[model samples]
Target: MPTSSTGSNPGYVPRAAVRRRRPAQPTRARTDLARLATRLTERDVWLTEMLHEHKVLTSHHITALAFTGHRTANRRLRELYFMGVVDSFRPLRTAGSAPEHYTLGKAGAELLAARAGVDLPATGWRKDACARIAFSPTLEHTLGINALLVRLAANDHLPLWLSERSATRLWGDWIHPDAYAHHGAAESDQLLPFFLEYDTGSYNLARLEAKLPGYAALAATTGTRTPLLIHTATARREAALRRRLAEPADRLDLPLATGNAQLADPAADSWLPLDSTGPATGRLTLSQLSTHWTNVTPALTPDTTMPTTGRPTTLPWRPIPPRPPADRT
Candidate 1:
């Protein structure tokens, strides 16, 4: 080997000639649809479906809807987050921390798409779904809508809850309500289905009154009167809204009512009809609302059945998530 370049043996390599390997970087947990299919419970699937439909839900909202306690919900949510089935973000606030808001993650979208027999793109989920919802100007409004529904859902009386997107999908051409729900006593067959308009008091009274025409148009076109329940942030706002809306509501024969959001029980005697004449001694319960609006027919059941020539079809949205299984212990 002719002295071998240095004093090293023929098989020995110099330190400079030796290749240095960088430390192995950790890899993220890969989301496997098959693995998730095997691992996810019915309740987990329901939560994901809810996230898909609702756009976003706070940790508190999720807990109220499904979990018995915050600890349990948080632990399970963390597991879901690691599994990439859901994404969450806590907004920056001036004082204290905000609850983690959850939105459908990539894995969740894939899971829902499979369940719906559609491709991922067809599900309308994007990689930035969480960020989009977190930064949107309507975040507060969205949460308000969800907060009201969560309270109703907690009572186990909310059978059908349609998010604004779904509601718009079904009736966007006619009117846009904050939400649509069918609520009643858990044991009763009767349900009170209505269009909910959650007013934050940001809109002027005139602006609020302008929405009545679209609702009137919807009622006239469908020939099915759906009560419009306006939930105001304060009693003063409710009073002003009632005053402004009363005339249009009556003239159009729109079955409408106003309620203060401060009421503890939304289903209780909290709703005041716009057409009430005498002193407001007592308010009406949600179930009693249909009774008050005598001509208002029962909400049309979710159906795909083709309608006769002139009538509008009520396209269905996903039903409310099934209640968590009873504790066997």
Candidate 2:
């Protein structure tokens, strides 16, 4: 065949002269992940576990749970994020800087699976999935739950944190709490299990009211009424929810309370008994909830409602090793 005069078959564009878009190389994250495996520490492992359980967390929450200070948490988290051990996205905010919210990344999931001797799923977590949660309608509600956990974890009293995912796994589909938790001083002084309902003031009141009966039914079935605690965004929302709870038709014998989420410490003396008309001054700590509501028995150990197969009572990792003391010299 005769070539066109530029390289030239007439009007033919040579393949060498064709502008082609090269396929993007695999992300740096894939190759960088191997370094994370060798550099992983116990603290890093625990952070991954927390992200897996909670689904997402702000750096502040991660610091409160794992590190001694903000700077260290930020530094370590930045490293982990880049190494593909965690992924993060910051949601749009009209005022003030929004903190980056993080979730388990592929490497983190693989590390966890290896630590637990389980196979990692073929398709693990994706950044887009986590990013959607940061921008989702439930973002504020999820943060409210995180706020509660942060405060509880900071206190000297030992608290056990359980995510809604684990709660659903254990308790099945009947009632899905925003979170489930237990606060205690000692084995005997421990408070009963409780389910948290974080209200963002975005849902219909009737829908909120409808769930009360289900809670009551859950109480009856378990032979123990686990207090259903509602944390509302504002005092108005709290008041409105309280009024809804007070309705004669809506009232159930279940132990319930509502708290303003803006309070300094949600787990403290902010929860007011929904059934009380005396005053809000008698708010109780989470553990003290039992002291005020005597009719309801404490939740059974490993709640009877827990489904046999799905209950994951412990993290794949052991208790976080205590941080070594800094050298005084």
Candidate 3:
């Protein structure tokens, strides 16, 4: 055989021959509107709408909301990322790496705008939306709210999980809750519509107490005694918050309950009603909690109110997106 490229030594390989193949170029997200539209699925649309409504969602949250497994979620999300349908960033953590938190990308906004018969700006999506959420001081707060909703959704098939933005649009004048949700018992058909206040223990106890007036106003305005569920980061915080909130909560006749955030089922017996007068008893499950506050009515239809010069409007938007259709074979 002819001498190898290594000159004299047939057994020796040239550096060029052994050089590592050029690392594959990172995939760039597609910007072609036509191509992306064709590739979109029902679930993809739902996810885009969710990102639009929720502002930010971690990979785990998205998976819990729609996907059956992490591997599948990651692969599909990677595809969406490359298609510019969703943009993501991984926050720096002191310990292990953080999961990528995703937001609506430019392409996603365009799609949503087109579907709604509105312009891109009407969708309230900006190129910097992802960056803004990624670096915001309230990122953890947002995540906490999302985490609670995700648990309710993934585990119990919660009927409604409204985002803070949507909740603000509807009730911001009275009270800007962290979120609004409806949870039902596994065995019963009764669903409890409640406003969620996810406390991270960042604010003074007085600040927590101050929120009662708005909630009272909301109840008075709508004539709906919606329960306000306060979830604290720790049991200790929950205890302190309950004590701080009890007097105001009672005086306003605001239906309030406190729970410590738990990794286990959030629907479990974790909540304690503030109206309790006696010493410690066991907590109540969300279903049991619903039974405790019989004054709380079922959620009203979205169209129950109309806007006039003097009248308030009901929540115009649906609390939850329509469930995605089953995947086609």
Candidate 4:
């Protein structure tokens, strides 16, 4: 039987030449966080930050916490509440008929607590801190991102810092990033050493291209040492992610296989990926647990209620101003 001459013809289309369409961008049902400039004064932002930072607040009790002025405190309380950044103050405390204490809601606290971890079921302190941190869906997102950050920080492969979404607060409508990454920003105080962001799902390159100008502007304000990083490692969506990784803007992208990945210490000249059995090819995952998590979330049970008893001592952010050098004669 003679083969079809058409198969040998130059005009015949190869099976691989079939038409292929571009992959659709991943969609995330993100929230719209309204950050009105007028909503809060700088003092208000500071107070809100403090409230979220500690996950508890009492204006009457926090005279030396982070800022001064009752008016400032009142202003922040009103602004944070109005902007929906906060749910309600602790135990709904109030004076003269109105609520006073500034407590983070499930979302507000979680959003601001971006450096904190939120894996409640797996860890103990993390669950408690997250519970104490209060519930904020935005915060929840940030919590996940921060958790990843802490993990990265622990990796000997890299020295990571806070960056992108959490630091500059430009996460589109979704106040919190899906992950935490590093960025270099300028802060006179040493408390906020860096900035970073975490975003899950694949995004269109052109869309992010548009956000660069704004990101660049923010970067200019950050310190010289800051560098921005963004990561997405959803195992279920790796192929789509890999395509995005090929884009030009992805030069800074760091790859983590999530459960499939293992980070190596830089001192080691060789690296080994996990073997089929799931055991680390080179070193054990970790024999000892670490206590360096930035924040932990705890779920509220019947036993866990608003911490009762007496007033709690407030911790102040005081770093002795860097000592000036002394000259030797």
* Candidate 3: C-alpha lDDT: 0.71
Report, for all candidates in order, the number of backbone clashes. Answer: 0, 5, 1, 34
lDDT against the true structure, each candidate = 0.72, 0.63, 0.71, 0.32
Model 1 per-residue lDDT at 105:
82
* Ten-residue region with minimum lDDT total, candidate 4: 320-329
lDDT of 4 by residue, 84-124 (tens): 45444332112212223445443344343332333212112
| Model 2 Cα RMSD, 1 decimal | 14.0
Task: Report model 3's TM-score to 2 decimal places.
Answer: 0.83
Candidate 4 residue-wise lDDT at 135 = 40
- Using all chains and alpha carbons, the TM-scores for the candidates as numbered come to 0.82, 0.77, 0.83, 0.29
> How does model 1 fare in lDDT?
0.72
Task: Output the worst ten-in-a-row residue range by lDDT, candidate 3.
Answer: 1-10
For each candidate, C-alpha RMSD in Å?
A: 16.4, 14.0, 12.6, 23.7
Tens digit of lDDT per residue, candidate 2, span 1-329? Answer: 11111111123221211111224657653444456678977678777777777777777777666667778888888888766688776654333344557788777877776666665652245546665665565555566676676677666443556777766665554577787776665365446557888777778778778777877776777677777888877888888878777873235666788887557676578888876544455778877876666655544354234344343333342322112122111
